[model samples]
Target: MTSSPPGLDLDALRKHLDDALPGLVAGPLDAAVIAGGRSNLTYTVTDGATTWVVRRPPLGHVLATAHDMGREHRVMAALRGTAVPVPAMVHLCSDPDVLGAPFYVMEHVDGAVLRDPESLRALGPERVRNLAFRLMDTLAALHAVDPAGVGLSDFGRPDGFNARQVSRWRRQLDGSRSRELPGIDALHERLAATAPELSAASIVHGDFRLDNTVIDTGRGDRVAAVLDWEMSTLGDPLADLGLYVVYLGTPMPAARGSHDPVTTVPGHPATGELISFYAEKSGRDVGGLGWYTAMSAFKLAVILEGVHYRYTQGKTVGAGFDTIGARVQPLVDRGLAALPREKG
Candidate 1:
């Protein structure tokens, strides 16, 4: 029998699955942690004949609303048969006794998620450009999905979504503030003053970036599956676009040692190209993007601060946590810069 990894109880998991899933685990189990996700713990498990991915909240320093397993599972399950690719959901376990927290299992997708500039560059310019086009198109496809048709009509509140996001992230920042963060409040206030009217609401992947997806390199334009849906909800679609642009502009530090630099990678589509493509593909106006991008930067700064908080508490369990806090200020500065110059 393979001994359980830290944070996973293999014996209990096997037993629970045997009882809950029936023949899902036919033999001894082995599991290895999947790094890169700072908010959740992901593991790959195999039982001699089959493989699956498991997602659970981080060991400690829990943010109850941010790392919800059920929300992640439900969105993916609802997205099946849609143009947006997502993993096949297998089972959801809510009993904390089985694994010390609720967790879910899904079919393991086989593809690469290029997170850095080097990895993307190795794919050649033409292929990287195609990947970029596909990335934006996929976001358009996701925005086109009807939540009611997919049984997710209640996934999130769409009314006043943009204003709520600003307030919500400020509350999150307040919870994780350890040191002085200049310009964050000013950025948030400006965002509030110029909150865009909700043109239309759709499913928003709170975090949408290159590394958040799996790609079939051979196909170039195919997105095998979109991963990390813990922050997904029914909300303003441009919020997703703004966050994507923010990620493109702000490359995470190499010292933090996660994935490669996305967007900044040579051959990746320019930010203008992405915005134009999204506008053309989704048929949505791009006029309010500046405000959204500022909001995205503010949101990301708060998120990194939370990660830094976990790192300080010794709750994080991977490389790069020590340097993550350093990335917050630059994001805050960028948010300040991205704020809308003209009144909306």
Candidate 2:
């Protein structure tokens, strides 16, 4: 018999699912926590015949605006017929009584989430190159989506999105402040002082990256589904592109051990190529990306800092968090460097 993972009540979950869907569970539900997520706690729940993925907030110290289950559910549900690939949202439980926090269930997508250089290498250079381009194309397709058409016109305030992002992330950093993050404040100040004008409002995946997507390895390495939509909203599309570039450039510390930076992987397209490809595919001007990239760095740093805060409070549910705090400063440094110099 398998015991329930921390923060998830299997018996209660089984009851809720059955009550909501009726005859969804055929046997006793068993669940195991899935690794890789640093913010939300993800689990794979099964009842012998079927499996599903459950997403909920961190056990403790969750930021007010982050980790919203309803927002995630709504965006994915709205994007079902769009070019963006998202898991089929099954049920969204707003009542926290069922789970300690609001949680949502979606069909388990079968594919690979390539996180490390080794995994990309396994696919060989040609496949890796093709996969990288496809990921960019997918991102273009997402930015091309009309939020109002998808019932998400009010998903987020697009006007002044960048300015609000700077303020919002600064507040987020304040909420998660446990230790002094050198240059982080300065980076934020620079971002605030030089916030770029909105460069086209569209649906932005707040945390878009290659790892957040599931690749259908059996189907020519195509993206099967895009996961982790907690931060999806209407905003400047360049913000999404900027964050993707940061992920490509940054060397993320693995949970167990470090791997080569994503850019070092064989056949991975250069940053310039990917940016140009997006511009051509999306027809959005790629100018002034430095500001967006710097802002993305600051945003990412705050996110990691929040995770660090949770880890310090023993609220985190998995490995890899120990190394998260250390990465914050580097991101800050990168952001500062990416900022455009003031006019003389």
Candidate 2 per-residue C-alpha lDDT over 2-71 given as tens digits, one digit per residue, 9 for 90 to 100: 7889999998898898899998789998998988888888999999999999999989898897989999
Model 2 spans with C-alpha error above 4 angstroms: 253-258
TM-score of candidate 2 relative to the true fold = 0.98
What is the Cα root-mean-square deviation between model 2 and the actual structure?
1.1
**Estimated TM-score for each candidate:** 0.95, 0.98
Best by lDDT: 2
User: What range of 10 consecutive residues in model 2 has the weakest lDDT sum?
Assistant: 251-260
Please name the candidate that would achieve the greatest TM-score relative to the true structure: 2
Q: Provide the lDDT at 86 for model 2.
A: 93
Tens digit of per-residue lDDT, candidate 1, span 198-285: 8799999999988889998766558999999999999999999999998887664431333444666668878898899999999999
